[model samples]
Target: MPTRRRFIKCLIALGAGLLPWSGWSEMLKIVNHQAAQAAILTNDSSAKTLDLIHPKDVSYLYHTAADDISALTASDFQGRRAGTVGEEKAAAYLIEQMKGLGLEPLGDLINKNTRNYSNAFTVYPVIEEFYNGRLTFRPGNSQDLRTPCANVIGGIMGKNKSESVILSAHFDHLGIFQGHLYPGANDNASGVGCILDLVRQLVQEGVKPKCNIVLAFWSAEEMGFVGSFSFLQNPTFSLGGLKAVFNVDTIGNGALNDFSVWASSDNEAVQAIQSAASEHNISIPLASHEGYNSDQVYFNLDHLPAVTLMARDWLNKNHTPDDVPDFVNPEKVALANKILYKAVKKIAY
Candidate 1:
């Protein structure tokens, strides 16, 4: 039986030393290629031993204070408009926080002069002008509710180009529907809070990566991953150089009392991620549902390794007005973040 400590040690040995990005990339290719061949030869038995460890032991407590903050942003807060007033404000706030945490805003610098607090993809311009400034399911109804939205982007550059990791989540929620303010507590505010805390952790440790860490707070994801899709088209860094992306969306209220990770089928990075989770006794249920639905869709299409993380199997509250705070389990959310942090460090560093 492979113990957790030995598992981590194996990963560390895979890198040997984390100083060069090319070396790490090369190592990843070799290990993943071997794993792939092994899978083909053996009939996918790798999962047999991997899934035995229980996921409950590694779960972390959801911080009450963090939950409160997420509640205010996703559910309790006012409107967020994409490329407009409210969303711009939210984007600015996120950038300020990132700057305060010692991370340089890489997206803006990459985009150059047009760089504002927020990063704009071309789709937002069309949505704001043609769609009449609302993220809607209805095509031609005035009664369609409007969502406040914004896309916040920031990054800490890695040691070099070949190795990069993206940490992303959507912060925008349904603004107003049927004269009631929709508090999207679990719908996505939880994801935003988790990303923010992850940023803080990276800053606190001052642990720079061998590849860059890009943090994005997408806007209008509910409106079809508009913000993220746009960013993907005009990414700050080349998509080919991207190592992996972790997309956290709607990470609240799971009926199963646990969460799962959905990894794209073409990605080889999933093995390393699974190995990392196994070290912590966390179970990541894998899937390959591709609809370009979330921010991860762009990354997936770009042929990069990517995965979406969220509390699994939540019913009913997906896009309704009832998706408010109190129902969310912050303990579950924090546990997800811890797993995310470990997965990120293992892959990026």
Candidate 2:
């Protein structure tokens, strides 16, 4: 039998030193990942003794993340509108809270002078003028339009560390409209909170996947996945190395215990989602569905593997002032995270 101490030693030897004060739950997850790594290096079949980790250990992640959903959607953020001071504040908040997660700063998108983790980009938003009987578009925006939005990122490397898997969510929402701030709690603040909680907790336990985990908080999704599209076109890193993408968006409605997934017939991505849903006791009422309404659509349409999670009834509370954090159910957000955790674990390996 592989002793726990030996597993710890093996992890340190492989350059994944323990923090010494990590709890048993954290230790368990790290031990399992390191054991699997050791087995691969030694080519020893018996070394494949990694146990199925219990999800209960990291339950704190869900709670903290769920609770913070309110903060992310608070009036202080001014709706986290893409290209506005609100969006910048939200990005700064995420970067600050997400420190030490092993994520490298994205290319020139991030401000070079500042330490905020962001993928800043300049996008030419189409401004349509409703003049006469026709509408025409011009590249770029007027003074009032938000021009500079940022995508936030972080990561945890799996075994290979070269192949990549993306866990994404859009954090931008409609700005103040008609004297109302679109709190955007459900539009995607919840999604952002969930992914952050999921990645931060896993990294806390030093749990590594079998492929690099890319944590992407996209911007300008309201303007049509501008941030994600930018990254795909002129990637700081290649998307060709991407194995899969899981997008979280608008999951704060519907039955608090249920979820809806938009996954096509792509076997690897679809099957993994189904399997993880089943294992985690999350209900995916249908085996296959397709949607192009959210950030994942950019990847899925281009033939890159992707899946999206949203509520079946999210349409009710989305894109309005009512979409405030008060409408977000923390329990459901936590459950969504659990399902993704299982799904990512299954796919990354």
Candidate 3:
């Protein structure tokens, strides 16, 4: 595979042709290029192997959750807005984490020599306005308003590769608006952190699932679910083979022991989640909704079985500068991690 620097340079070159904002594109190209090079030089050489001893205790879980959230909410990521340098940097970070976990790359497999974990896609301008905090899509195509984005994907292959289960979290948030940063800690960093720790525990314990377990970190979710919509339109794997999709979002900053789950329908996926919560002694309140929010929307629209887990006050710090890591509850995040881990295991194993 090409070095990270070379890969980003290629992406920047390709993006220049598609984007009309020459000044913005040029600035990002320079920033991303330098950042990618710096990352390569300082990259850790040690692989995250099972041989490395770790105390799999409650404290460790809290530490891991805090670490992941802090990293994502760091100022260097600049809010991780879609189609921006910050989002690209976050994607690069996820790629490294997935690599460390020994996951198989399931995106950009066309070029064997440069296979990567990025499923690059374009987000066309469609929304006319945000009426009552809800987006209304425009009818006609506006090619000039297209934005570039990508989804980070990795997976653990199981004995039955023909079937798969997906655990997803969107890493994108509203970028700096009006000169203030919306750090997106509880909005989504919590979800990403929870999934990362969950997978880490699974790998460390050597649990071999029956169906492939895909870890998908979606981009452009704040942009009306464009990344996931694109994935559904042109998936890297066979969508028909997907047994279930469990999406985690905003699982921090709420009541310490309170959580909510909404499903596409009353199906096996929902049953699996309920069973996992019951077995693991986790409290997850099951509820019913239209499933129009979060990354699960596209899958639900396709009539595919999906569910979303949430544990945050939507009107509190969401999309605001106050949404910083300080507000995130590590205990709550760890609880979410445990719930998702057990739920996915029940379905995949």
Candidate with top TM-score is: 3
Better of 1 and 3 by lDDT: 3
The lDDT values for all models are: 0.61, 0.69, 0.75
List model 3 lDDT by residue over 1-349, tens digit each.
Answer: 2576576667677667666775444445344434433443453442222122122232232236577788888888998888889889999988877877778888877675555799999776544444455323333376567778899998877778889999999998876765777789987998998888887666554545788889999998887788889889888988788898989988887777677777656666666777777776765666654534788888988988888888735446666678888888888887777777778877887
What is the Å distance of residue 219 in model 2 from its true position?
0.3
Model 3: CA > 4 A from native:
1-63, 112-114, 125-141, 280-292
* Rank order (by TM-score, best first): 3, 2, 1
Instruction: Please give the distance, in angstroms, between residue 287's alpha carbon in candidate 1 and its true position after superposition.
Output: 3.4
Stronger candidate by TM-score (2 vs 3): 3
Per residue, candidate 1 scores C-alpha lDDT tens digits across 1-349 of 2453365458658687763775664455444433433333443566343211111111111123264345345522564534345455556666666666556555645344544446655322222211333234422343555433446776766778555788888876556655656666776777777777776555444445778788888887766677787777677656667778888877767753366666556465566556666777766667545543567776777777877777765434665566667767777777767777888887766
TM-score for all models, in order of appearance: 0.69, 0.73, 0.76
Residue 230 C-alpha lDDT in model 1: 71
- The alpha-carbon RMSD values of the candidates against the true structure, listed in the order shown, are 13.7, 8.1, 14.2
lDDT of 2 by residue, 1-349 (tens): 3565576767555543544534443455556555544554464565454322223234343235655577777777888767778888888877765553445554454345533467778655555333343222344554544477778876665677668888989988776765777788888888888888787656544545677788888888876788888777766556777888888888777787677777554546656666787887655754344434677666776788887888778777566677776788877887888888888877776
lDDT value for model 3: 0.75
Q: Which is better, 1 or 2, measured by lDDT?
A: 2
Q: Report the number of the highest-lDDT candidate.
A: 3
